[model samples]
Target: MKLAYFPGCSLHSSGRDYDKSIRMVLGKLGVDLVEIPDWNCCGATSAHVTDENLAVLLPARNLAIAEGMGLDILAPCSACHQRLVIAEEELKKEKFQKALKETTGKEFAGKIRTLGILEVLMGKVGPEAIEKEIKTPLKGFKVASYYGCLIARIPRVKTFDDRENPTSMDRLVDLTGAEAVDWPFKADCCGASFGITQKPFFHKLSGRLLDGAGDFGAQAIVTVCPFCQLNLEMAGYKEAKETPSRTPLPVMSITQWLALAMGFTAKQAGLSSLLVEPGRLRETVSR
Candidate 1:
């Protein structure tokens, strides 16, 4: 099962662990990820808001390259997945395709399908297949699976799970034999939008998510999006400092948890990149 892989900008920089864990997990699953050639940024928030055509053109160019490969695209970043999916959907229309071709110098047929790594894991490779690869089942590990707001909000673009109450991450957590705690705010925004400009609102929104997970007695918050993990951890830090009662929960990537349980060490899974350290969780996996 070879697919065109798009790691996006964040995966290579701030989310390097996501790339490492994703590659490790897919390699073990017998799925080959061929990265799209000369892939450019999907222009997630800024491009779309500033220049609409440029936004579409950015992701469309990447999709056009994948179309040549004759394989579906597997995007790891949530924003990249959303941008690519949205670009594909828009390109299907004649008017958008015409403008896109003028800008990108290539006519796009929207032949390639875009899927987040989560969709590929849950649909293309079954959980049972992942279960067979686990060296240590994450028993007694209570995790809050945070999907953020991008992955499944648009059912038309990403039809993998319910937008409001997503359980794909939960199901993946369950495969590790970990307890996926039932908690509200699973799909809530992590306030990535205002993380820089509006610090107070950013902390408030992101802090609430961390607080909610902790309130539910979640030991760790498992997330698929790097922005969410980064923001949540940032907010968690501020939240912990102000409120002594709140113990900062370790925010981990989906693949980080999977890679660790599947016999990969913390260093191998890029656990050191995480802001909030999983001290006990690391100790448990080490033992």
Candidate 2:
């Protein structure tokens, strides 16, 4: 199967590990990814706040390009997936359609669909297919599947899993032979960009998530959003430093974990770039 891949801004920059793992794992699953050419930022977090039309148009252009390619889009980042899905919904309205045409000189045929990585993994490539490719099952590892806010919180748009209690990522983690701990913060906010704008509040929110995961006996926190991973790692790092007895929970992108189980090296999955290393998880994988 082939799809148009949109790495968005974060995946190309802060979320490189996610991009690497998604490409590698999907390639291993016999799925081909054709990147959207000349793709721009999806206007996540900032664009919609400043200018709604600009936010819609930003992803609409990418959607138009993907529509021309006649392939569904696989946007790995949660924010990107949400933004693209929002644009698709907006395009259904005549005003947004006219705006898109006036701005980009292109027509949106609404011929394709935008999917998050979870949707692609669970819907397109089932866990059974992935199970067949696993070379090193993470049999005893325990992780918390963090979904953050954007992936499934959009009320109007249809999401693959339950909005409040998502199990898609948990199921994927379980397929790796790792146990996805039943934790309360799965769909909670990860304090997002607040880590930069409002440090204290970000710490408080992210700290609660880390504390919750740790209390539930989670060895690591797995996520699908770059901001979530970054924020959680940042919070975990500071928390560990503040309290010597506390160990920083390794925050990993779900694709990175899948890549490890599929026999890819840590370097190949960009694990070295993470602020909090998965030392214990690495040992378990080696064993």
Best by TM-score: 2
Runs in model 2 deviating more than 4 A are none
Against the true structure, candidate 2 has what lDDT?
Answer: 0.90
lDDT of 1 by residue, 21-112 (tens): 99999999999999898999999998888998878888999988898888899998888888888888888788888886787777777677
Worst 10 residues of 1 by lDDT: 152-161
> How many clashes would you count in candidate 2?
0
Please give the CA lDDT of all the candidate structures: 0.87, 0.90
Q: What is the lDDT of residue 45 in candidate 2?
A: 80
Per-model TM-score, in order, reads 0.96, 0.97
**Candidate 2: tens digits of C-alpha lDDT, residues 1-287:** 99999998888888888888999999999899999999999989899989989889999999999999999999988899999998999899999999988989988978999998999999999888989999988888898999999899886877998899999999989999989999888999889888999988998899899999999999989999998998999988887788878788899899999999999887787878988878877766654
What residue runs in model 1 are displaced by over 4 Å at the alpha carbon? 155-158, 240-246
